[model samples]
Target: MQSFGTSARVGYDSSAFYDRKIYAEPEEVEDGSSEENAVPELNRLYAHSSSSMHELPDNSVHLMVTSPPYNVGKDYDEDMSVEEYRRFLTEVWEETYRVLVHGGRACINVANVGRRPYLPLSAFITADMIDVGFLMRGQIIWNKQASAGSSCAWGSWRSPSNPVLRDVHEYILVFSKGDFARQKPECEQKQATIGRDNFLEWTKSVWEFAAESA
Candidate 1:
């Protein structure tokens, strides 16, 4: 695979790198068809997302679901200020908007951070996505019932002083590019139907589920 870009920072121009051979070359067929006409093998690329996204053609992806880093000193997270984090997210969302199809949907699962001053990360991301020309869709609340009692921080302990609320839920912000309804072929429409019971349950706003085990 060609090196798309060495830098992991956001907004880095990776146009200097070339070659779309990130995926495996399709096997040659028995017929006289050339490799150019062969379908490329689907493979995962482990690289910078912004750099890798540049390789994809515009209006190619149908759906995108992502959970960005919380930037709360996680091992894999970089130490960035709130402004820097907002810029990073905006750059990524811009790339997402470029790659998505006309009616493609982007779902972001995020939670607000409980720092010195509470950070509404999901709200910030929603604004950023809107600024990139994505239409606002409804948001889903993922209520993690199992983690309701996980936090023991009760500021002032029953006094009427400063108190902090424990967060046991996350927000899934949905947005679409260009249009609200995704255009699909008849065959895909038949295959994508959800069951009646599931559809009814999933359409509601709040979803009760347990948190994933670390």
Candidate 2:
């Protein structure tokens, strides 16, 4: 469970950290080979982490960002009650907040998920994030093209026909660890005050980005 890092140099003993021996209670991993491979994978992800943010020195991480697993019940390996899921996320974000620098920013590219029984997943998640102390910034819409709308439908509450039209939009929620800027007004304001030499067309929520564009 030893970690090492300072500026440029960093490394870890993946084998020790992922040692199944320590977590034997969770059923001994009789298959030793799979566990061995997972060790290196762990190292690759946390190679830059400095002691769970606490050991890394204060305000060390410039950018803390991740795409949290969209819990659409698409084989996330857990069917936990939404409350439990929220708790898990609570811990994850608490740690993230602890590590983020005073001015450091955290961006979670999360999409909403909705299954039977539960209601709007994104709406609930959005509320939970704000409750967890992260300042809510404006959301970015990603109108990506991915086949046709599945019979599964999108997360937001909608109908076959609505005024909003088809939900070709996904959410890229922008949240900060603390009382951070609601939006990066500098970029927005600068674009305004600095003045654009070119014509500025109004942008819509729906974006049509393609893998291959002209």
Candidate 3:
């Protein structure tokens, strides 16, 4: 594990950090290995990272930005008990740890959710990550401006009986595989190029942005 960069680069928008351009299929060489063989097989557009990460070469990923399913009964996710969900996430992260370049960073975005019993999903995830060999570095609050229409959902409108607050934010938990200072050079690592405005906003622990509409 070599030192990659001393400073942390930031970006306010997730889209700003990644290029959407699709790369051409790598040409097969004489030995039959293509350029893609040089990196993780999961380093592609629209990959099922958790399942495909096992195919990635160890210490290949510099940064991973992901939003795991919240198991809140979304159409795409199966609702599992809190314990069951945590165990499932633990497995995914275990594989993530193996594929990250030493000192690599992982950014997990999750929001707290629930009705009768509120669950601090981010808190659970943070603990789970630390338990699985990652060094927690920072926690960023992503304020999504969800408070405006929240009054309608307030459980006991004007009553003091089990009232619930509107959740308008999510968390961006940062963790490193090893010492961030012991990473490789910046030239050898994947870095995000951001504009001045975005850089300034991203530097703050609390980032304010609206959620992208579906």
Number of the predicted model whose lDDT against the real structure is largest: 1
Best by TM-score, which number?
Answer: 1
lDDT per residue, candidate 1, 1-214, as tens digits?
Answer: 3355655545654445323465243322122211111112346664776624756767667788999999989898899998999998888898887777767789999999975788999999988887777887889999997766655465645655766677889999998887766657555656647899999899988999888775
Q: TM-score for model 1?
A: 0.75
List clashing residue pairs in candidate 3: 2-182, 2-183, 2-184, 3-183, 3-184, 4-183, 4-184
Please write out the lDDT profile of model 2 over residues 144-205, one tens digit for every residue. 66643444345435554532234445666666654453233243355345335432322343
User: 1 or 3, which is superior by TM-score?
Assistant: 1
Relative to the true structure, candidate 2 reaches a TM of 0.52
lDDT of 2: 0.51
Root-mean-square deviation of candidate 2: 19.2
Instruction: Score every model by TM-score.
Output: 0.75, 0.52, 0.71
Better of 1 and 3 by lDDT: 1
Tens digit of lDDT per residue, candidate 3, span 142-173? 98885335454645777667555767788999
Cα misplacement distance, residue 133 of candidate 1 (Å): 0.7
